[model samples]
Target: MLIDTHVHLNVQAFDEDRHEVIQRARENGISHMINVGFNRETIPSSIALAEQYDFIYSTVGWHPTDAKDMTPDDLEWIESLCRHEKVVAIGEIGLDYYWDTSPKDVQARVFREQIRLARKLGMPIVIHNRDAHHDVVQILREEKAAEVGGVMHCYSGSWETAKMCLDMNFYISFGGPVTFKNAKQPKEVLEKVPLDRLLIETDAPYLAPHPYRGKRNESSYVRLVAETAAQIKGISLEELAGITSRNAISIFGIK
Candidate 1:
């Protein structure tokens, strides 16, 4: 079975037919989905989904875009939710220089703090990086994030940089971009990454794969990503699913 390691079922995009969306994912052979919450607002929704479905899991943290808005009380609340039975990781957290929603300094500070929190709680992290690779990896190293390894969601970097992340005990995950006709880097990176360290996601209601590109993404489309990864790796679809599923279990500590 395929496991979508990163998705956002908590957002408004799926509020109309969230159940249908999840049902479709299961119908498409997706066995599990991690609904990631990157801000205080979405955290409750993420936890709610996890509470509702046995196969759904939750993650809580502030996105770098919202980093400046986080407070000590909010961090404490996130730590509190860590005790929830289905909260599997602290993430969707990291740096996003493209949006510059938060100042670089603030982004770095919050990202580092979350990494420390994950280490303290002995939980893996779910990273979100874009255009800030240098500082993101540097902070990860400084924070000793490898002590509680995590996944680099929608990884956007060269194989060399990916190797650095792998050395730091991180798995490189790919999403819809790999299916784009002109996506050269991700395809190359997919081929270079070792099977054990590879993972796939849809980032649902966001980066849907081709044919569904630019449309509202859903978890079921992870099969498209799986197809792309399998084709790139020259493996059968079932083989890719089994490998990625095991990798997800290893990182998320899912049962």
Candidate 2:
């Protein structure tokens, strides 16, 4: 079975046929999916999605891009939401220099605060890092994020950076980019990351894998990521799926 460790099923893109999309994923062997809420607005939607679907879980936090609109009270509200049983982690949080939506300092402060909140709640985190890799790594270390281990969702970094996160006990997740013909960095990281520390995701409604690139992605396409990892590690598809699913279970505490 496959577990899509990161997905945005609550996004508007899936509004018309969300249920069908989920059913298709299940039919394709995706047993579980973690829907991430990256801002205050989406938090309730994420929780509702998780409540509506047995296999869907939610993670609530402010994405770096949404940091500009957040206030201290908003952070407190997010902390309150984390108490939900269906909420598995505190994230899609971290730094994102790829977009200048929020100032770097503000993003960093919000990210650190969210990390601290996750630690206080004794929950893991789902980190989203972009061009701010170095700063993200530094902040995570300073915050001692190792206490509440999590996954670096849709990881796109060098082997050295991945090792830094692994040392902090973060699982390395790969998405569509891993299957891109020109994705040398992610491919290299995939090979370097140990099977036990690796997880697969589609970041659905976003990063579609090869043959489906530039199209709307879904949890069902996670199989392509598994197949790609199998080829990279010289393992059978079944073995790859088993290992990665086990890794997902370990990280998310899902059955």
Candidate 3:
């Protein structure tokens, strides 16, 4: 069985055919999906989806792009939801220098706060890093995120930077980008990541894999991702699926 370690089924992109999309994922051997809820809009929707589906789980936190709007009350709200049986981790939270939506300092502070929150709750985190690898690593180091190691979702950094995250116990999760023809860096990084510390995701409604690139993505397309990862790892699709599923289970503490 395969596990989509990161996804966003709670978002509006799937509103029309949400159930159909989920059914297709199950039909395609997707066993579990970790749906991330960042910011005010998605958290409640994410929790609702998890409650409605046995195989679905949720992660809650503030995205770096929406860092400026994350109030103290919002943090408290996220903390409260972490107690839910289906709430697995504390994120999709990190730096997003590419967007430049929130100030760099605000993003860093928010990232550090969520990391501290994860540490306090003894929960893993799901990170979303975009064009801020240096500060992302620095803040994670300063915040001691290694204690409750998590995932670098849709990882797109140099092998050197990946090594740093690996040292901190973070799994390197590859998504649709790794399947693209020109994605040399992600492919090379995927090849070098230790099997036990490797993961796969769809990040559905975004970053669709090859043959489906620039289109709306869904969990069912994770098979394409697995195929590419298996080739890169020189393993069978079944073996890669089992390995990545197990890694997802281990990190999320999903029973």
lDDT of 2: 0.93
Each candidate's number of clashing pairs is 0, 0, 0
Whose lDDT is higher: candidate 2's or candidate 3's?
3
lDDT, residue 192, candidate 3: 98
- Give the lDDT of residue 66 in candidate 1: 96
lDDT of 2 by residue, 5-120 (tens): 99999999999999999999999999999999988678899999999988999999999998989999999999999888888899999999988899999999999999999889
Task: Locate the minimum summed-lDDT window of 10 residues in model 1.
Answer: 100-109
List the candidates' TM-scores in order: 0.99, 0.98, 0.99
Regions more than 4 Å wrong, model 1: none
lDDT of 1 by residue, 21-43 (tens): 99999999999999998897999
Candidate 2 differs from the real structure by a C-alpha RMSD in angstroms, to one decimal, of 0.8
Whole-model lDDT, model 1: 0.93
Highest lDDT scorer: 3
Off by over 4 Å in 3: none
How far does residue 174 in candidate 2 sit from its true spot (Å)? Answer: 0.1
- Model 3 C-alpha lDDT per residue in residues 1-255, reported as the tens digit of each score: 999999999888999999999999999999999999998999999999999999999999999999999989999999999999999999989999899689999998889999999999999999999998999999999999999999999999999999999999999999999999999999999999999999999999999999999999999999999999999999999999999999999999999
